[model samples]
Target: MTLEKTPPASADPSPPSASSLAWARRRGSVARFWKEYRTHRAGLLGLAGLAFIALIALFAPLLVGGDVQSVTNAPGTALEKPSGEFPLGTDQFGRSLLGLLIWGARISLTVGLLAAALSVAIGTLVGVIAGHYGGWFATVVMRITDWFLVMPTLVLAIVLATVMSRSIWTVILAIGVTSWPTTARLVRAQTIAVESRPYIERARALGGGHGHIMTRHVLPNVMPLVLAQTTLGISSAILTEATLAFLGLGDPLIISWGGMLQDAREAGAVSSGHWWYLAPPGIAIAFVALAFTLCGRAIEAVLNPKLGVAR
Candidate 1:
């Protein structure tokens, strides 16, 4: 009997590890998501454009060096029209417009991202709390939210930015605080809808606490909405930042698209018909905003087929 020898060794090893299984599932989910996303031509184009700009922004220093922001060492004469020496022309301070545009992207994109993230984080937190614990707490939060909703967001942001020290963080803070009410309202509505589901009740019955219900159940369910909102919010944030910068509220030291516009205005570029001074930054802003909007709409459509992607 012993000579019969043991059965052949198992052809397969033990089941995949928990992490491995999870990673496999995530990989599949990503692939499926991408497959759907690819169907949106505008989204793909927008994504490509944004990616290219982001790379330029990411490598600004290496591509053009930091001295581009320095007026004292500008490579060309002030407001020189675009030519071989300076393709995008020069700003009022004689800094290369091309270099300023590139450097500007880094700061502008960063502010947009950070401001959007801050707005979303606040909104998500308020939404989850209000949704998970309804009654008096939700009532109070919604009341406050309603108050904010009724106010003019831009006016409020301007007020905050004006009162606070003029800096990048101030701009971010102003944008973040003033812009979150819409997201909070959105998330709250989604949360209320999500909690009405049967699984929420089951989770409650299973001894789940507020934290567990909110983080595990509510957040995941509402994440698609949050993500779409975040994407859209970035465009809004960028526009807002530009508005602020144009109004001379942005950080003076930061060279950004908006700042370029402000500088051009100060230099009488607009009145003088020096289109070169203003066109590049203006186009960049419009293109970047359009790209974010496209990606945002695509994501919303992908997450919820009811909202089809715009053509």
Candidate 2:
């Protein structure tokens, strides 16, 4: 028998490069997530609605013909009913209701996004630390989280907003600070579960550092839950800001859907049967909230199989 010369060890094929492996992993993750997400019809609709709203906000100036002041302060057009000249009619300030609605969408979306990001960041840090350490640190962190949890979020947010300057940043901060406890609890529970996995134990045995393991391993596993919570958080943050604005605590310099509602109420639009003033903003808020709720539910269903089964 002729023996074929064996290839030297140095000539052995190399394993995939680290960068290629990482790219493949990320591509797989995104593909899997999209597969799951596409199965839910309501999620798709909600996503479409959100995208439409974002587009309107992005092109508000162009849509309004770049005359923001004319739309926002047309004193000559005050209280005009919907007509060919102004489709959505003018507010008490003679500003185009359509213009105000478009602009308000921008503010509401911005605050929602910022507040959700801040809340998620704080919650993730607290949860990761508490779950990873699991000692006096965990006890202290959980206690603080519980303290915030027991308080009514809206009431706490209102109080915080009142204490700070009435500005967009103030509203964003107030909502974020008050909104993190639930996320912290969720992340902590998920982290604990992930930490107990055999792979994590193997990592620890291999002398993996806490920061490295947590960031590289634990955080990725917990991110689906974080994403679901973030969608819900955006809706809640928007509603909370609206509540504050309706109560006359919103930034005076900015127009918002809630501020429009407040102005309509103060101007007796509802009592005077001016449906044009009251309907658009209320509908906008309700529509946006419903969209977020639908999307969040769909995400939860995908991430938590139990919920899907129950549904």
Candidate 3:
């Protein structure tokens, strides 16, 4: 009986499928990126701070009543110092500074994100078209980019804002149009490099059209640069928004850090030593700028490990 019994035939198990392996590789890459990014203390701190600020902005309605912005029924005295009842004190109109700061964060962050997105979109389009379809087209595009690059971004933005209607969208559009040249130059260089790769040539040989190649290959390759540029651009956009507001180009109906500063100046905060009025907004602006810069640096480090090593 023992001799007659034979082991049942077994089939060999197949290895992981190509798609599964690829998915696993992507997951591993993301994990590695997170691990590496966590090592950046400044970046982590900045990210945490940004998260806190964003939460405050997101929960502003729940945190503070709408009456906080009311000039007629203000809950505190104008320029009151920080107190338990009204932490961070009140603005010239007796509005709660804490509430104003939180509300202002929504506007500031919105402008920064929207303006940077618009700038990046325009820049990426210009850069890819210029780089992919080189020669005369590229020359013209580069000339345009150069013209924008050479001009002071602030001046251009100021001019645009001055001509446009005085509104939030106007500020966003002004900043968007004026701040794109730098991103254009960067993306163009990266796109050119990507287009010259052997894979791109192979893709061309495989009957891929310009649109297919650019969308499938070139865009993915240059996305890292675009992402980094966008993060960095947000900080610049926020600063610009503040500048525009301070210069009286911002919407007059909203509470913004820059508007706060402008009010402080108009109220002679400097001479009166209303440090409470000036310091909060100034610090808020600086804090946001530093946070974005730090996060941008970390994203760069993650995308280019060599950069992290160099640092």
Winning candidate number (TM-score): 1
Q: After superposition, how far is residue 232 of candidate 3 from its true place, in Å?
A: 0.8
Displacement of residue 44 (Cα, Å) in model 1 is: 0.3
Clashing pairs in 3: none
Ranking, TM-score, top scorer first? 1, 3, 2
Model 2 lDDT tens row, 238-270: 888888888888897788888888889888998
State the lDDT of candidate 3 residue by residue for 144-205, as single tens digits. 99999999999999999898889999999999999898888989999999998999999999
Give the Å shift of residue 85 in candidate 2: 2.3
* Pairs with backbone N, CA or C atoms under 3 Å apart (clashes), candidate 2: none
**CA deviation > 4 Å runs, candidate 2:** 1-15, 69-76, 309-311
Residue 4 error, candidate 1, Å: 4.4
Candidate whose lDDT is highest: 1
TM-score of each: 0.95, 0.91, 0.91
Candidate 2 TM-score, true structure as reference: 0.91
The CA lDDT of each predicted structure is 0.91, 0.88, 0.89
lDDT of 2 at 200: 96
What TM-score does prediction 1 earn?
A: 0.95
